[model samples]
Target chain A: MSETAQRGGAIPPNSATPLVSLRDIRLTFGSHQALRGVDLDVMPGECLALLGDNAAGKSTLSKVISGTYIPDSGTITVQGEEVRFTGPNDARSRNIEMVFQDLALCDHIDVVGNLFLGRELNKGPFLDQKAMLARAQEMLEALEIRIPRLTARVEKLSGGQRQAIAIARAASFQPKVLIMDEPTSALAVAEVEAVLSLINRVKAKGVGVVLITHRLQDVFRVCDRAAIMYEGTKVAERMIADTNLEEIVNLITGGH
Target chain B: MANYTERAKQSHAVEWLNDNAQVLSIALFFIACMGFFWALTDTFMTTGNLLNVVRQGAPVLIVAVAMTFVIMTAGIDLAVGSIVALINALAAILMANGFDWVTTSVMMLAAGAVVGLAQGWFISFQGIAAFIVTLAGMSILRGIALYITEGYSIPIKDQAGFFWLGRGTLAGIPVPAILAVLVAIIGFIIMRNTRYGRQVVAVGSNLEAARRVGMPARWIVCSVYMMSGIACAIAGLLIAARLGSGSSNAAVGFEMQVIAAVVLGGTSLMGGRGSILGTALGALTILIIGNGLILMHVSPFLTQIVTGVIILLAVWMNTRLFGAGFKLGKKG
Candidate 1:
């Protein structure tokens, strides 16, 4: 176990294979080819920022990888074993999770209930409220999100807090590769920082993260490696420390 | 200048009132209605009148509970009234054919499930518009009911125990009322506390997001229709017991009443927003209005038009008054 952990390429100096390896991924919707032979590897414990503008096929690629839409042709390998995800649940079962931009939370329900949503922790016939609440409390605490009322309806929560709950929900499943689609797009600056901090904390656990965002600042701050998507293909890949934002922006717009 | 603070406080209060105008207006209407009835009539608050109110509200409440789930997904079921008619006719015909009570009861209830499955499949899996599928279902089911009974009321004679499913009471409360409360509690648990329940609301609010999160959007959408159908079947059974017969035209205007109650309770017809509690209250409010009109000697035909206007007004108010303060996010 330690051998695999240490030899994981992006995990550490001795870490094992990349957690997610997408090779020659191609997808088209209607007449548009959203992803054109895109190739990338998400190593364990590393934050890979997928940076691009609108129509850069960032959303489409994320969906394909997360099982929202199957790739027209591609090979997705987890830990060196190729797998095909037919749907979101299939991806999730393989420990690949996506926290969508919308959060996908039920507003009428309270915090604890929303956290568990599809993957509920149950006891016999009834929902184990005590058990779920305790686990949720622990998860929130781990994420350092202070939701004063666990029973507070999600509609009543502020934007930042709701985002926190959503992130915490994704983390609850203990996913190996957590994909976030512009998780900070709707947040204020302070809320963005909060999410950034949470992302950093998750990174400490060695969970590989694929962050889909247009924010170059977030890429610089949190990501170790940045992959640029232009039109339907990956135009450039840069290490965060070695490259500046200007070149990446140029790559995104396909000028460089 | 002399009363600047006082003026400021008054303005602040008015601003606060404006912010909560939707809830405040509904409260004010309730108060005004109660006061008008109290002043004009002596027997308005009597137990007998209230019991009459419960009985009248029972059928609408049953249908609205189903509507709650449908509207939560931003979908509508127009076949409810027709479904009630069909179930009623099924029960009556089965009894006439010498079917045992338990078998007949299960068979009658199963009709709703079959209808729900058919319509739900089209709407959820087949990707048809809910309005068109249920509207077609409404026509088809009503025709089936009429054809089953030859457009006449079928008197139930053999299924004495089955009649109790609708008419039998526990302690002193009406069976339908008890059943309504039970259904509400179950609905409340599912909608407010369970994972499957949350998935329904999530899917209703935003299909793409729900799918990305690994929710079984198709199944959730389909189940809600089943729920609506079951509720309608229950209402049909109770109506048959109360009338001691089944007819094609039973609960003729029930869909309007159910939709009115759900809208009044603040469930958005646009999907992804609704509450069973609100739906129940909405049903009760409609019941109260009808009862008040009847007690005040208002004509039934006019009462329906008034009810329709009130529903329209309530929905309009929901948008105009509370739309700003309570704006729902694009996604759940």
Candidate 2:
């Protein structure tokens, strides 16, 4: 294990506290245990890939962090202070935004509209279309994303373009802890590369990102640390520098 | 630069056509209907007849404007006709009971909003489907209207101002028509320019997306119904004022006309995509068809059949033809 893995990334001289710290989080649904005593810490300026098989509780744990599901018993600490989220809005207010696998874009709305979905800029009672348009262009350009027209409805866009817009929407707001579930699932090779680079940029901005994905190659590209989940419990945590593909794959398959 | 376009994409012109297809198709249909009426009837092209068409169609237009908002959010308000009938009867009864026209109008409008709020509550907050809740509202409200009027048309004895709302002309235009036009303009502004309008489209397009983004999704859904309610009050007041009487039968089969107008204007039944401009054109087209058919000495029952056929045809064009890119001369 690397020094960062041994101390759980807590010994860094400049940044000591994790952005989001979870301890003994457990949740159940009927007869199935979705999560069991999972302890994890998301440090600032780091990307953590959460790896698991199909019923490995990756989504459940991400939802718990995003406030979609309230855990039955757990301690959720943001900035070292214990807190419980009542809903996604509560999590959002604390600057913890999640990009779900579905990329919740309103298909009928225009590109600018989806980018500013929840928080729209308005002048008087009307939507500040000019301001929003200008700002939208800037946000997309900053991320090196290009949509032919900002006013075109999102349904008219391609899947990769749609995925890019969804990420830009969540990433542009400067969230402290950004959680993305399978964001690159719909992307092609070049699009995936763009996303990885974008993740690196977001990490540099001191935003702790929780990436839940099936593509393990993407894990090596963007993730600095990884936590593997088996059944409902987190089997092991590995620092990216000290871990390889085989070790993480074994950890996910319950090999110690 | 990272090109996000991984596959073949549409050109800007094709995309624009796809977005505006419904409105354009409806506009063309409106013009075609007008020309057909003009070529057929000598009297239909006259200003007097046109003004009369607008005047009579005003009440339906008012309700249709609100219906656009309701349907834009992928929700339906089936009880609008009942609301109009209830308000129509209630307005006359209140006037007969020594209430002034202004006060009665205010009270009637409030009642309309309350009815809408109640229905909205059941549909949105209570998680009931909008169709079921409003269907029940339609029955219950019409029943209330029948119960109150007791199968009688209550007359308004002496209210010239109230009478003017329905029967009066403003600058050679009917007051009702003027009011309806104003409401349509306001509805256009709201749906196109306002933040609330964007939210309505957002909620209708993908409700889960809207909620996830922290929008007041339930409140927005509920408020559109409230708008429908307030519009019903206006339409009711106009009818009562015009006829100088109110009864349970004031707006019989009125819902059919208003809904047909909305759907004909290219507002999708599935919600999320609608245009107030399209609705206004739709209301006018329906008005022209009825007026033109009557001028041609056709049976009154034929108007209903024609209107039903038009609705079906228009919706078919909307979903089947316009669902794809609206290429003017290009073939697949």
For DockQ, the strongest prediction is 2
lDDT of 2 by residue, B138-198 (tens): 9999999999999999999899999999999978999999999999999999999888999
Model 2: CA > 4 A from native: A1-15, B6-15, B324-331
| Cα lDDT of model 1 by residue, A49-124, tens digit | 9888899888888888788889999899988899988888888898888888888777756688778776677776
Regions of model 1 farther than 4 Å from truth: A1-16, A28-33, B1-39, B158-170, B312-332
lDDT winner among the candidates?
2
Candidate 2 residue lDDT tens string, A157-249: 777788888989998987999999998988888778778888888899889999999999999988988988888877777788998999988
List model 1 lDDT by residue over B196-300, tens digit each: 777888888768767666678898899889989988888888898777888998989788888888888777777776777777767777787777877888798
CAPRI category for model 2: medium
Chain B TM-score, structure 2: 0.95
Score each candidate by Cα lDDT: 0.80, 0.90
Fraction of true contacts retained by every candidate, in order, equals: 0.26, 0.79
Please give the range of 10 consecutive residues that has the lowest summed lDDT in model 2 chain B: B1-10
